[model samples]
Target: MWIKSARIVDPGQQLDFTGNIHIEKGKIKAVEKASSPMPGTMHEEVIDARGLWVFPGIIDMHAHLREPGYEYKEDVYTGSLAAAAGGVTTVVCMANTEPINDNPSVTKYILDKAEEAGLVRILPAGAVTKGQEGKVLSEMGLMKKAGIVAVSDDGKPVEDTSIMRRALEYAATFGLLLISHCEDRRLSEAGVMNEGALSSELGLPGIPSAAEEVMVARDTIISSYTSCPVHITHVSTQGSLEIIRNAKAKGIKVSCDVTPHHLLLDETRLYDYDTNAKMYPPLRTGADRKALLQGLASGVIDVIASDHAPHARDEKDLDFDVAPFGAIGLQTLLPAVLRLHFDYGLGLMQVLSLVTVNPARLLGIDGGTLKPGSRADITIVDPSTNWTLSEDMIMSKSKNSPFLGETFRGEVVYTICNGQIVYRKNGI
Candidate 1:
């Protein structure tokens, strides 16, 4: 496979150029100047990519591909197809399935199913506690051996400091990352939306910013003690950003991800009782949003993820207070993020880094690079293409998205995973 006349953006080394990428045996063989074609390459299937931008396929460090128990929402095969359509070649699925992915057997089941689906690379995150009960630790060693990439209690936070500390120390020995959903259950329990004037005016239960900030602070300090890598997923508070920034400055092995919704929308968008905007670490105030943007631009935030939590329409059609937290993000991540970058003056390289190299680094994978010898996971995007987002056009089994009906200025034209063309636009 040969991709010709493409503007290549290699975030690994901060390199960008118009080049031709050659792939053989599912690996990138070479990236050469567009003018220099191999003298005897007659067998290559050349793809003209003029006017399109190619980058390492996007990686979502946080996603929920409900399987084993919760196929009603999404399964490995359908979720992977949604990921491919969104230009994501790799996804790290959170351990929030029906029967939580806490044991080696369950982890293996998910991985094996994903392998059979074969649409995208699925890296499963094992649960930190057995069944995510937050009481006892799971078989971390066993799960790691079964090919789990990381451990997380995504839907709930591990509130017991002693147990969490032990998990961190144990995880460090095996070089496994501990990704936490930073929220103090005591402060956030039964809270429906962001705690602010909006929630007050709407007569809804509110989840204060401290619910997230307090946990982030605790985890960072604990991580410092254990000398292990701890990642905060979907950080949405101003105070949480400050804590993460200071932790990184203090040389603590801590990283955090910001969701596209957090970067592009605020709590005010919830005025219409749109349950899609209701998510854990709920959409925050304008000030928090501003701080999040600054965090992304200043490198305090490490990556951008969809936090693609897909729920059934019935699950999301409840009253705002009773609706489950989260919405589908796989299909809308790129367009929503690009709108903020191009229209708001964020550098293209910086934006791409949030989704590409930055996430690969978090997962300790060799993706997010166009370097020779690397796997040929690539996405070609037209930055100038304009279209409105509609739920009907998405490939996910669930149609729950917060950005539906919004017009955006970018589109993914082609997606190549392991040298196989997984998706391509009709007329591009």
Candidate 2:
């Protein structure tokens, strides 16, 4: 297959030009400028992307493809379809499923299901603690052998300091990356939204920013003490960013990712008691949103992930006080990032890097480039297209998105993974 006459933008390679991406046998055989033309008999498939944009397929480091147990909300195939529609060709799924992915068998099961799905690269994350109980260490050595790119007890923090320290040290011995959810259960439990005037006015329980900051600080100290590289996930507060910044300044091996919802929305959106606005580490002040944007622009934040947690309609349509704390993000990630690029004055390359090269580097995956000999995982986007997001267009079984009914400026028209065109928008 040949993608011809497209504006190729690969931030990892510092490349931007009108070019052709030639795919052969599931690999990028060539990435050459338009100056080179193909003979009539050279290929049978040609995609004339005259005015379109082609980029390295995005890698989302924080996604929840609930399989092996909770297939009701989402399965491997459905989640991959949603991801492919969003231009993501690689996704690292959290180990927060019903039967937590602590042992190697669950990891193998996820991989096997993903293999059957055959839409994108699905990497599994192992639980940091056995059964995600935060009490005993998991079978890290055995799970590593089964191919977990990272380990984290997401949706639940390792609150036990001594246990977390030992987990860090043990993970480091196996050369694995440790990811933290950065929330103190005690401070965040039963909270419905941000802890401030908004929660008070709405008569909702509040989750203080300190809930996130306290764990952020603890993880930093543990990383320092253990000499292990730790990654903080979904950082939502200015105080947490400051702590991470200070840790980086001290030469501690630490990294972090921010979610699209945190970057784009604030607590004000919850004034109407929209359950979709409910999220763990709930949105904060306008000032916190500004700080998170600045962190991404200034390189304090390493990448952008969707944290694409999905819930059934019956689960999300309940009263705000009892509704689940998450909103689907797989389909809205690009436009949210584009707002940063086109409106906030961030370079397009920089915005694209947060989803592509940066996340790939964090996971040590072999993607995020259009260079010759790389995998043919690519996404074609139309920057000029204006469209409204709706439930019918969502490929995932769940329609729990905060961005539903909102208009956006960009659209992903096609997604190719492993040289296969897994998703393509209608009419082109």
Candidate 3:
């Protein structure tokens, strides 16, 4: 197959130019800049990619597939479909399902299900502790062999400091990255939204910035002491960013990512008792929002992930205090990154790296490039297309997103995973 006349931008290879990409046997065969396909290439499928942005398929390193138990909310098949629609070719799913992904059996189960879906790639995250109970370390080496790409007890933090340290140490030894959900449960306990004026006026208990900041400090410190690579996910507080920034400055191998909702929505979204805006490490003030954007520009934040936690509609329809702290986001990841480019003025390549090259490097994965011999995972986007997100537009099994009704200036027109066109906007 040949992608002709596209403005290919593969940040993984430091490449940006009008180019043609050739694929054969499900791998990139060549990247020829400012040139037409070779003679006799007409027999191959050629994609007219003119006027579109061609990127290495997006990689969302944090998301909840809710399989093996929470299929009612979302399973592997449905979640993979949503990911394909968003131009996300690879997803590192959290280990927070029922009967958590603590053992190799669960890891293999998730992988098996992903194969059945035959859409986007799914990399399971093994639990940091057994059953994610925080009492004992999980079999990291065993889970790795079973196909888990990383270790994280997302949707819940390992409250025991000793366990967290051990998990970090074990992850380092196993050559896996430790993805931390920086939240001091004690500080965030019973809180429904950001602990500020809006929560007070709405008569809702708030989750304070300190809840996440304190843990960020702890995890970074542990990472430094143990010399392990720690990745903080869904960071939402200014204080947390400062700690991560300082840690990185000190030569600590610390990296972190921000989510789309946290980048766009703030505590004010909760003033209307909107359940979709509710999330763990709840969205903070507008000032924190600006800090996250600045972090992206200054390179403190390493990537922009969806943190695509999904909950069933009935679960999200409850009272503000009782609703689950999550929303589906797989279908909005790339568009939100576009927001940073168009609205915040970050260079397109720079912002695209947050979802592609950066995460691929951090996770030690492949295919965030159009380089020769690389997997043919590409996302073709219509930069000028603009539209609003409604419930019907959501491809995830659950429809609980703060981005609902939000309009955006760009959209994915085609998503190619492993050289197969898994998602086509007009076709879907």
Candidate lDDT values, in order: 0.88, 0.90, 0.90
Model 2 lowest lDDT segment of ten: 37-46
Task: Give the clashing pairs for model 2.
Answer: none
lDDT of 3 by residue, 73-116 (tens): 99999999999989999999999898899999999999999999
**TM-score computed on alpha carbons, candidate 2:** 0.98
Question: Judged by lDDT against the true structure, how good is candidate 2?
Answer: 0.90
Return the TM-score for each candidate structure.
Answer: 0.98, 0.98, 0.98
- What ranges in model 2 sit over 4 Å off? 39-42
Instruction: Output the lDDT of residue 192, model 1.
Output: 90
Off by over 4 Å in 1: 38-40
Q: CA lDDT of 61 in candidate 3? A: 94
How large an RMSD does model 1 have?
1.2
